[model samples]
Target: MSKSGYFVSFEGIDGSGKSTQARLLADHLRAMGRDVVLTREPGGSPGAEDIRKLVLEGDTDRWSPETELLLFTAARRDHLERTVNPALAAGQVVICDRFADSTRLYQGLARADLRGLVDQLHDLVIGQDPDLTVLIDMDPKIGLSRALARGDGEDRFESFGGDMQRRLRQGFLELAREFSERFVTIDGNRPVEDVFADMRDVVGARLP
Candidate 1:
């Protein structure tokens, strides 16, 4: 954790329950009397939220991998400036549903092996990362099922089908390895409470 404030980010394939876990952590912290700023990427700030609708609600082919890389990077910059930075600066715990790591895998490797460009853009703009990243690991098939069942218009990524989800899961695992110092893998195949419990434990040990 940084001296300014603890930064925790949750990541996983769609429907892996990462968002739910992030929310649970924030609630737990708040109940404990800690100020928490809970937010999500691609939509944390107003400008980023507007970008989110454009990128997530369109067809799978709505944008190329390069385009997505730019859009997501831009949104992340806005989010950091408007939502994440201030909270951390204020010594508040900032729990984010997703962060630039998502872009590293989703737009970086999963899309077209644009990982090089992804890293460059991230290093250039969004230089910071989560103090701790909780990755809810699960079978891609299971995640895809839950994601499709949601029927949310933001299913642009899920609409790619099971194969893509499997690849995404693999890529995320690889990411956890590459950035092992900050990534914690939690099994998300179990009950929601169980998953949240493990996540909380990991985060509790790390928070200042």
Candidate 2:
């Protein structure tokens, strides 16, 4: 499944700086004269963007856990086909803000028996996983506090209680353990520059 380009993903609870660090990695790679494509799951392609709104903004009262997982998979499928696979085919390093892991952490951990569904979707739709996944590990409380401080209105998942967030955090750590070879767990309590620097080093080692 190896390709000429690398696929890197950033994962973490809200406000753990996955998006910021993902952009930093992409910028750093581009500065090194590498072709880099920066994209995000749930909204990379136009069709996925439409699905994103449905997942984030639409009412959840009618949404079951399985349904939520399917919507995310649908968006991810569109994103992969439209942005990720093509960019990699052309030899571009692809750094994504979030991917299949988020669904596992947020939905699978939050909802009962949903992890299995997410896993099945990964096997059926995602097919190829990221070559490297930088997991920004942080306390759920700290992460949620930071998210609220940022003043962005709470999204569907962010609106959950502390216990749920704690479970999600644990889920991420568990995943990191289960996929140790592909996962790099970063201590996210450090300053943003330090975190980005650590990430840069990891990506640097993988470059040509």
Candidate 3:
């Protein structure tokens, strides 16, 4: 890593196992005696977690997409200020389960017109990108099945339905292409061990 902290984020459609991989990577790096800070958004910080409940819970129609975008951006700003930025300044490796890209795919590309707003908000408020983003690619059918099985009440985004999931998958893939230098697309349909091994390889090669 540089003088600053190394930032890595895991991304994928719901239940694609990016969260699991993020945890595993954090563990692996810690075993290697590296300083690591594992976090997630839009709830990594105290203020953000409160916002998380507002945005993630409630009826699917609780907030319009635009309102939801604003909530996410607000949470992200708090997360960056209270968690990510300080950790990076201290030179620790920060592994996050999701970041701005999730908002881009979920709220932005899900509707064509919203993309411009997402980009503008990102550039204006949340101006940083992860040094590395591990995109776990998987079939929407399988991913949705896994997500539904989790039974977590935080299913507002998941409630967007199958058509939305397919679009999310495509949106994430497009992001990998658009930011190829920072993205590593991993096949998430495989066994957990296989996925972790691939993630380990990518992360190891990039560690300072």
lDDT of each: 0.91, 0.83, 0.91
Q: Where's the lowest-lDDT run of ten residues in candidate 1?
A: 1-10
C-alpha RMSD (angstroms) for model 1? 1.3
Model 3, TM vs. native:
0.97
Clashing pairs in 1: none
lDDT of 1 by residue, 1-208 (tens): 2448889999999999888888899899999999999999888999999999989987899999999999999999999989999899899999999898899889988889999999999889988998999999989999989988888778999988988899989999999999999999999999999988888888999998
Instruction: Flag regions of model 2 displaced more than 4 Å.
Output: 58-62
Number of colliding residue pairs in model 3: 1
lDDT of 2 by residue, 1-208 (tens): 4567789999988878888899988888888788999999779999999888777753445477778888989999989888998888888899998898889877776766678878887998788789899999888888888876875433666666577778877888999999998899888888999998998898788665
Off by over 4 Å in 1: 1-3
- Candidate 1 vs candidate 3: which has greater TM-score? 1
Pick by TM-score: which candidate is best? 1
Ranking by lDDT: 1, 3, 2
Name the Cα RMSD for model 2. 1.7
Query: In candidate 3, which residue pairs clash?
Result: 1-208
